[model samples]
Target: MEKRNKILNIEQIHTYYGVSHVIQGLSMYIEEQETVSILGRNGVGKTTTLRSIMGLTPPQSGTINIDGIDTSRWQPHKISKIGVAYVPAERHIFPGLTVEENLKLAARPGNGKDAWTFERVCDHFPVLAERTNQDGATLSGGEQQMLAISRALISNPRIIIMDEPSQGLSPLLVQMITDVVLKFCIKSGITMLIVEQNYRMALKVATRHYLMDTKGEIVKVASTRELVDDPEIIQSHLSV
Candidate 1:
């Protein structure tokens, strides 16, 4: 299939955490209706790259284009209004609120008038519906991650940037999360950029992949088949 139009265009983002340069010239793009994965070891600028695109950690220099509009200068909320959603690695949920409440806060329109509803999100994760009244703090790591994603879906974004969606989950739950992401890309035609350390899970869900080295630089970009078949690239850049 010919690739869809680019939904996100992140070009040469240079970001810093105080005096430390974290992300150096990182560039990547997410095409509409496609699934892309950002693979790297810890502290390889994966999180920083997501943050830069989200405007939480603004880049000193870069161009962030969402559906063709350059939004590098926009604030986080403004960028979000342009149809981009971000789910951080930390799983930011309102600990005091119930799962239902969290989703309500994140709710927005999707492509047209047919946006995501609370029932639809619960249907995606039936377990969430079962625990609708449960407090966020009480949910398991995997459940929290589910809520994080459901929250993003409520926004009906064109492209969702996920930072470590599989972090700290049991193997079973990791599979669940991966399944949901793939379903979204296939069924809903939602574009996504996921940052994950679990190579196998990432490969299964991603159409294309990009690897960031320890220096916060993009080292490799390939199709999922190329990524998984070529073990040398993983050994060279991501071996622990």
Candidate 2:
């Protein structure tokens, strides 16, 4: 059997916000080209997990290895330089910039190979091509989400971390975003760690699922097939 490369590894990370303790000794790993979803109720440190990995909120004690290099103490910009892209839930595109401009600003030849060009990203998201001149603030929520994902892709990241990609969208738009993500995963073969409250949509894109409890601990990790067949697991961990 061929060995799978571990692209991202988080082990025993403890993060805190001021005096409030969160993300108590959380550990997880994502293999290359794999899509893993972290599911939990709101405020279970789902967002914090991503933030910790990105160095936005550094963990006080833990090791984050990216491609076998320890990066727990690396700054967020340094992390990005190593081919890690983060798309937060807020979809923080430059509101005043044109859609094309936003993508241009984020374009980079990551790792000095397999760089994503403007044309390629536009091909991946044709809607973005049509709205090239539109201001980032003018696009609809779904469009803004696309732009955000596109901005990340333009960086040619090895792994993409997303927070609630499907939040606040209509069912049709959700399905559309899912399709885009699935296609991107299939084509690019880039690893992803997504934190989502939309269980159905997350399940659709992720091959593996990690269930987090209220205390920010990952209580279970299972294949998507297993989790989909077991609603009790979802109910026990995710239901209000």
Candidate 3:
């Protein structure tokens, strides 16, 4: 298959968390309409990498480019407005708000044809429509995850950075999440950069994969087929 246009490109980024250096010269790239997965064990700066892209954790050095624009100097909202959406694993929805309200709150103002509406999100996640009036807190873990993804989709982003989308869930829920991601990539044509520990699930949806070592460095990158066919690469870096 032909490669899509480059959507997000990170070059040698370095970050810190209160004097502790993290994300040392980490770089990655995602093409348009492609699903790219970042795989690594826990505490390896995978979340930090996503934070850096969202400008939540500003990098000390290096550049972040989204659709050829220099977003390294942009704020989180600015980056978001430029079509970069983030779905953090924490599921940042309002617990007090209803499901519909949570979706509405994320709706962008002055967005054009590509912007997502409540109906569109409901179409993708029929359960959200069924629970439109339910309080966000009452939803199950899977529902919360769906809401988080819907909230991001409501922004109509050109690219979405997802962190641990399948964490803390039942196997069935994980499969559902995986199916949703694949549908988004294959059907909706949405570009994505996902951080996941479930290598098998991730490989099922991703076209390419990157590996981050415990030291916050990119140790390897390859196609999904290569990563699956060669288990040694995973065992070497991802093994406990």
Best by lDDT: 2
Instruction: Please tell me which model should have the higher TM-score, number 1 or number 2.
Output: 2
**lDDT tens digits by residue: candidate 3, 1-240:** 887678899999999998989899999998888889999998999999999999999899999888888788778998888878899998887988999999998886436655578887887788899999999989999999989988888877788789999999999999998887777534666888899999988888888999999779998998988987898988888888
Report the alpha-carbon TM-score of model 3 versus the true structure: 0.94
Report the lDDT tens digits of candidate 2 across residue range 1-240. Answer: 788999998899999999888999899999999899999998999999999999999999989999999999999999999999999999998988999999999998754445688988887788999999999999999999999988988888889899999999999999998988888753687899899999999889999999998787899998988987888988888899
Alpha-carbon deviation at 34 in model 1, angstroms? 1.4
RMSD of 3: 1.8
Model 3, poorest ten-residue lDDT window? 107-116
TM-score (all chains, Cα) for each model:
0.94, 0.96, 0.94
Q: How many backbone collisions does model 1 have?
A: 0
What is the lDDT of every predicted structure here? 0.85, 0.90, 0.87
Query: In model 2, which runs have C-alpha deviations exceeding 4 angstroms?
Result: 110-114
Clashes of each: 0, 0, 0
Model 3 residue runs over 4 Å out of place are 1-3, 109-115
